[model samples]
Target: MPLTITIPQEYGYVLLCSTATFILSNWHAMRVGSFRKSAQIPFPNHFATPEQIAAASGDRKEAMHIFNCAQRAHYNFLENYVSFLPALLIAGLKFPVSAAITGAVWSVFRIVYAVGYTKKNTPNGKGRIAGLYFWPTQLVLYGLAGYTAYSLL
Candidate 1:
């Protein structure tokens, strides 16, 4: 006899959402790298520091702004994703369908956040507004995940 494990449909949705998130995150990172290269910042030997990037930019304020925006977007994604991933996993195991739907929502908002952050000279504070929407939804999703996991225990 062979041993088998079954995962719920909701969990499958979570997996799909997670995959989408991973792909989008990497795409943003690559965009940042492109910005850095275009700015003529030397690619990191091991790790590139803010000082090193600034030194490379050398009086090019526009280049510096673009580099900074890209870096901010990258870091922001990492910060949110790190915490969100585990919560999403736990929640999906307990409340798969809802968790998966929430995860998808979170992923979409994140994309909006990144685009808002990266776009140059966005009018009417659009990027900041988008970020405002993103944060609350992210927080709510994390909370829902935590509550779902806790209820199961």
Candidate 2:
């Protein structure tokens, strides 16, 4: 059999996807930091803006809320990307095109999701929608990878 460990074209695409995600994550973090600096306050852990704080409370509460949102988003983004990267790599070696396509789809959804989540203070509906739209693509990639592995047995 051919050498399976050689880098595949799909792997390169997946790498691009990973790099894009990292850039976006850092970009969002910086945006959050900008907000915090502008507010001249510490960050929050839940909401993304102090404006989300209860009406009864003051600006500090709102700022805290925004900080919290930023923190949660940052961590979650890291976790998701890390988990998916290895999977992409595995799939790439065995099923490069599928892996690359799935990675591309995921990257697009993530970008949309982040913008929707941050700009409108809304839920991740757009992102979720994109995810749903991309599910079939991901499944196809996963299936291809699994098939490749099974064939080797």
Best by lDDT: 1
What TM-score, to 2 decimals, does candidate 1 have?
0.76
Model 1: pairs clashing at backbone N, Cα or C within 3 Å:
none
How accurate locally, in lDDT, is each candidate? 0.70, 0.60
lDDT of 2 by residue, 1-153 (tens): 674556765467767765776787778678668656644554443344435455425655544555555555555567676656666766777777677778788767656555444443344323334334434555565676677667656
Score residue 6 of candidate 2 by CA lDDT: 64
lDDT of 1: 0.70
The residue-level lDDT of candidate 1 at 48 comes to 46
Q: Which ranges in model 2 have alpha carbons more than 4 Å from their true place?
A: 1-4, 43-52, 55-64, 121-153
> Candidate 2's error at 91, in angstroms?
0.7
Model 1 lDDT at residue 34: 80
lDDT, candidate 1, at 126: 53
Candidate 1, residue 57: Cα displacement in angstroms equals 9.8
